[model samples]
Target: MIEAVKIKTERLILRQWQDADRDPWRAMNADPEVMRYFPAPLTADESDALMTRCRDGIAQHGAGFWALERMQDGQFLGFVGLNCIGHDIAVKGQWEIGWRLARHAWGQGYATEAATASMAHGFGPMALPRIIAYTASTNLASMAVMQRIGMTHAAAEDFDHPLLPEGHPLRRHVVWEKIA
Candidate 1:
């Protein structure tokens, strides 16, 4: 097993999601601001399905995208972790590091704080040689975070998202890689 892991930083706690978190998580996932980069907000059923995948990821890999909670009141801020989002090109079974937070959870350093720990866990404890992150070209906030984390752009590796339209505003996603 991956062990019941808990990671703490100066201000955040990254832990596995609970059944009670479903509602808040679903609500966040449905927010227009939160889902703006997304093509569409997830339905309630999709939220449950995502939670199931989140639970399964933790159980299977010992650590996946974990729900981010504030230490003071134990609020469900958001989530940060690694996931094998299948792959593109010659890279197979790619494990990509990603994060998502409620609108209230933005502006603080929580995403970076949680993600920094996650990167360490992925490359350190998990011994992953590298991790990839992809995001919509226009999502400057997310792209900024990736750069802040020292990930470099692989422009030649960019591609149009298969699920999005051919010329959708968010169709082109830039790939960022952190190689050990």
Candidate 2:
């Protein structure tokens, strides 16, 4: 088993989930604007279940979508880290870097800051050969973050997400990859 780890950046901390993170995480997940790129906002139960899985992944793999915290005030911002894609998507079975920040945390470069740290940890200590990031084709903000972190997009690597049904506006996904 991989040991639990925490990564720090110039302005953020990428660490494990905490008890106090629940409410803020729930609120972020429930925000329509925050979930706009996805299908829908997560309910309280859905948020809790996702947290449980994140925690479990951390316990089993030593890393997951880490709880992002601002270093200045120690406030819970959101999450940015690595996770394994369980489905047969373009990056299936690969470690994928992702991030989600509260609306208040937007436009501040926090996602990019935290994600840079996460990518370093994956490529350095984790010895991962590469990391992939993907999002709905319309999510320019997320795509920008991926680019800022040095991931490259290839049109041939794009694929329709299996979880999103046919005819869904967000079914088509663009994938970005960063090689070690």
Candidate 3:
């Protein structure tokens, strides 16, 4: 069944989002620090729409960003997985592996662990030859996670995010990738 492919990492359950997840999902996106790299927080309607998009994408594509949760207590922990992104050099039509855990979940290895699983899914089950982790140049925390997950910086091949306006904070992004 489509619902059965929810992937599990060490301490997190990457599962399909339920209708109940909208409130917490909205709250997580509404966090200023969590939405720092993105332009703005999603309004309630926007958040609802986003979850719908994610759901539809997965239903159509078989894999997309899954709703992550704590395995032990079933606590929602935002998301970690692959999403099609604005493409660039060295690898075109790349699936971007990414994560966003709550502030309470930081400093733990959750992001890295969950990301590792997603990366494996990218290279293994998903059978993609490559996956990338792109982040704002100044986002040390995100960069650290990328490094922790064994991705190496591809500085020579990095490109300023085209979707970001010139000089936007997220425009100065560094890319790290893993290729099989």
Candidate 4:
């Protein structure tokens, strides 16, 4: 089993979840602007369930989406880390990197900073052969972050997000990748 890990960047802490992170994580998940690319903002229960999944994944696998906190102020910015694709799709079983932050954290390069750390962890310790990221076609901001972290768009590998029903605006996703 992989060991529980925490990655520290110059301005952020990429670490496992904590009891204190629940409320802020819930608040971020419920923010409409923050969840704009998602199908809908998460309710408290939904947010809690997601948090539980993140916590449990880290416990079981040693790495997963981690809580992102600012080192300077100890604020919960959001989360950025690697997760295995549990869905039955082309990329199933692949490790995917993702992140979500409060609107206030936007345009600050935090996502890029944290994600770079995550990619290193995946490649360095996790020894993953490849890492991938995908988002709704409309989420240019996230796509930009992927690019900033040196992930190249694999347009030919793009696919519909099965969880999102056909014809859903968010179903059409764009894929990006970085190979170790």
Per-candidate TM vs. native?
0.94, 0.95, 0.88, 0.95
How many angstroms is residue 144 displaced in model 1 relative to the true structure, after the best TM-score fit? 0.9
**lDDT minimum window of 10 residues, candidate 3:** 85-94
lDDT of 2 by residue, 28-117 (tens): 999999999999999999999998888778878898899999999999998999998876766789899999999999999999988988
Global fold similarity of model 4 (TM-score): 0.95
Query: What is each predicted model's overall lDDT from 0 to 1?
Result: 0.86, 0.91, 0.81, 0.93
**Model 4's lDDT to the true fold?**
0.93
Better of 2 and 3 by lDDT: 2
lDDT of 4 by residue, 18-125 (tens): 999999899989999999998999999999999999988888889999999999999999999999988797788989999999889998999999999999999998
Report the lDDT tens digits of candidate 3 across residue range 1-180: 254268887788987778778888999889999888877888889889889877776776677888889999988888888887634543456788888878888888898888888888878877998788787788889989889888899897677767778968777778888886
Residue 39, candidate 1: how far off, in angstroms?
0.8
Model 2 per-residue lDDT at 66:
93
Model 2 clash tally, residue pairs: 0
